[model samples]
Target: MRSSVDIETIFATMAVGLVAVASILMTSAPLGAQDGSRSRPVSLGADDRAAALESVQFALAELGDGASYVWHRGHGKLSGVVQPTQSFVDGKGRVCRHVVVLLSAGEKSRKTEAIACRLENGVWRFDS
Candidate 1:
C-alpha cells in the first residue's frame, strides 16, 4: 500500500500540472485555430455541458495520463471524450491534471483543453 506521503506527492504533482493548463487556456488563443482565423467556440446546452463536466471530473479524478472516458447523453445527441494528458502540482500545492474534453452534438463538435484541480474540500473543478 502507498504511504500518506506518497499520496500527497502525487496530488501535489497533479495540482502543478493543472495550474499550467489553466495558464495555457488563459493565455493561448482558442483551440482549432487555422490560417490565423479564429474559430467559433463549441457551444453546448446547459444539460449537455453539465454532463460533459461530469465525465471530465471523473476522468481527472480517476484516470491516469493517456486514459480516456467516454460520455454520452441526450439520446446520443450529446457525446464526447475526456482524457488527461498530464498531471502536476500547482503553485498552491493543489493536485491538478491537464485534460482534453471533446463535446459533440449531431454534426458539430467542440474541443476544450483545461486544467482541473482539487479544491480544499477535495472536490475537483476546472481552474477558471
Candidate 2:
C-alpha cells in the first residue's frame, strides 16, 4: 500500500527512465535510418570533401571488401558511393585498394572503378 506521494514519485522515475532510453536509442540509430530517406545528392562542400577523403583513407586502411563510404561528386553534382572491391600489395610494398564508386544525379547514375595506392606519407593516391 503506497501513499499518493510515493505513487507519484514512482511514476516520475519511470518517466525519466523511459526518456533516457529513448535518447539512447535515437543517438545510436544511423542517420539515414532515422530520417527514412534514401541516398540523395550531396553537395561537395569543403567539410564534405574532407569527410569523404577521410572515409576513403579509413576504408583503404581497414581493407574490408564491400566496405563503403558516401562522397559527393563535384563534376556530376551528385552523391556517390565509394566501396572497396579488392586490395593487394604491389611490388613496391605499397597497399593498393581497388574501389568501385557509383555517382548518381537526378535519374542518372554512373559507375567507375579505380585503384588507389597508399603512399609513404599515409595518403591514398589514385593510380591512373
Candidate 3:
C-alpha cells in the first residue's frame, strides 16, 4: 500500500519527465526546419515534390551542372518546352528525363539538348 506522499511524488516525477521531453522537442523543432547547413530547404521529403515537379527539378539540376552549354539553373519551377527527343542517363544507373531546351538570343534561336549522366554517386554530368 502506497501512502499519499508516495503517490504525489510519483506524479511529480512523471510531470517533470514530461516537461523535459517537451523542452527537448521544442528545441529540436527549429533544427528540423533547417537543413544541416541551416540554409535552404531540408527534408528529403521536401526535396522530392510530386512526381512531375521532382522530375523537372532533377532534370534542371543535371542541365545546370552536367551540361557545359547550360549551367545548372534550378529552373524546374518555371515552365519550358521540352522536345520529345530529350533523354538522360546518369553514370551509375539513374535515368533523368532529358529536355531539349531552346535558347533564344535576339535573332539567334539556338537549340541544345541536355541529358543526365547516370553517375553511381548521384553526381550528374553531361550524357547523350
Candidate 4:
C-alpha cells in the first residue's frame, strides 16, 4: 500500500525516464536504421543522382540556410554511396579529411553535386 507521496514520486520518476528515452530515440533512431540504406552520387542516371543526394539531403536538413558546398567530382576510395567522414580546416585554411569512401570503377560515370559547410562562431555557415 503506497502513500500518495510515494505514488507521486513514482509517477515523476517515470515521466523523467520516458522523456530521457524519447530524447535518445528521437536523436539516434533516424540516422541509424539497420535495414534501409541511403544513396550517393555515382556514374548513373537520375535515380543514381537521387540515391547519392539522400546523404546530402540528410546532412542539409535543419542546417543553416547560409551554408555552402561545392562540386567535387573526382576519384575517391569510398566503396558505398555514403561513408563515415569528417571535415575540418586547419589554422592555415587547409581542409582535412577524416574518413573517405572509395567508389567503384563501374560507378565512375555517375554525375553528382555536393554542399559543404563550416562552423563559424558556434553555428554552421555556408562555405565557398
Candidate 5:
C-alpha cells in the first residue's frame, strides 16, 4: 500500500546506509590487505626483538650519516638493516642521531625511524 514516493525514499535511505557501511569497512581494513601490495610486518619473538634492538642501538651510536649495518646475520629469525641518516647535537650538547631501521620477518617487512640521543653517561637511548 506504500506510495511511489515512499518507495523511492526507502530505497534512497537503504542506499545511503549501504554507502556508510562500505565507507566504514574501507577505512577499517588494512592498507596491505586491501591493495595486496604490501604485507604488514610480523612481530618478532623476544630473542629476535632483543637482537634487533641491540643492532639498532649499535648503528645509532657508532655509524656515521648514511652508513648502514646489517643485522641478524646467521642466528635470529628477524633480519634487518640499520642506518644512521642524520646526526646533530641537541641544545643540551647531547649528540642525537636519526636512524632508519628496515626490519623483515619471512615475507613481511617494515621500515621505522627513530631518534636516539647520547646520554651524559655515554649510553645512547631512543627517545620516548
Candidate 6:
C-alpha cells in the first residue's frame, strides 16, 4: 500500500540511474568508434621532445641508422625514426628544432621534415 508520492520517487530514482548508466557507457566507448574524426595532434613540450629524442637516439644506436620505431601518443600511433638535422630560432622568436622523421604506417610511408617550436606555455608544436 505505497502512496502516490512513493511511486513517483521510485520512478524518478530509476530514471536517474538509467541516465547515469547511459552516460558512463557513452563516455567509455573508444574515441575512434565515437565519430568519423581523425586523431588530433598531441602537444609535446621541449622536455617531452628531448625525452622522445633520447628514446629515438637509443633505438637508433641499437638498431643503427634509418631504423623504424613505433611511437604512440594519445590515440595516434606513428612508426618513424627521428633524425635531428639542426636548430634555429623561428620568426616568432621561438627556438625550433629541425628534424626529419621517416614515417611509415601500413602501406603508406613518407619522409617529413618538420620544425618543432616551443610555445610560451612550454609546449612544442609543429611549425611546418
Best by lDDT: 1
Q: After TM-score superposition, what is the CA distance of residue 29 in candidate 6 from its true location, in Å?
A: 25
Candidate 2 residue runs with Cα over 4 Å from true position: 1-52, 71-77
Kindly give the stretch of ten consecutive residues in candidate 3 with the minimal lDDT sum.
Answer: 16-25
Give the better candidate number (4 or 6) by lDDT: 6
lDDT comparing candidate 1 with the true structure: 0.58
How high is the CA lDDT of each candidate model? 0.58, 0.51, 0.33, 0.30, 0.55, 0.40
For candidate 1, write residues 29-119 as lDDT tens digits: 3223323545553333445545655666678888989998987785665677879899999999999888876655555455666687788
Report residue 116 deviation for candidate 1 (angstroms).
1.3
Model 6: colliding residue pairs: none
Candidate 5 lands at a TM-score of 0.61
In candidate 3, stretches whose alpha carbon ends up further than 4 angstroms from where it belongs are: 1-91, 118-123
Model 4: residues >4 Å from true position, as ranges? 1-43, 59-79, 87-101, 105-115, 118-126
lDDT, candidate 4, residue 99? Answer: 23
lDDT-better candidate, 4 vs 5: 5
lDDT of 5 by residue, 1-128 (tens): 11112222322343222112112112233223434666663333345545655776678777889999997636544577878899999887889887766665555445556666777877666564
TM-score of every model? Answer: 0.62, 0.50, 0.28, 0.25, 0.61, 0.37
lDDT of 4 by residue, 26-74 (tens): 2222212323545332233333333333434343433233343332323
- Candidates sorted by lDDT, best first: 1, 5, 2, 6, 3, 4
lDDT for predicted candidate 5 compared with the true structure: 0.55
Ten consecutive residues with minimal summed lDDT in candidate 1?
1-10
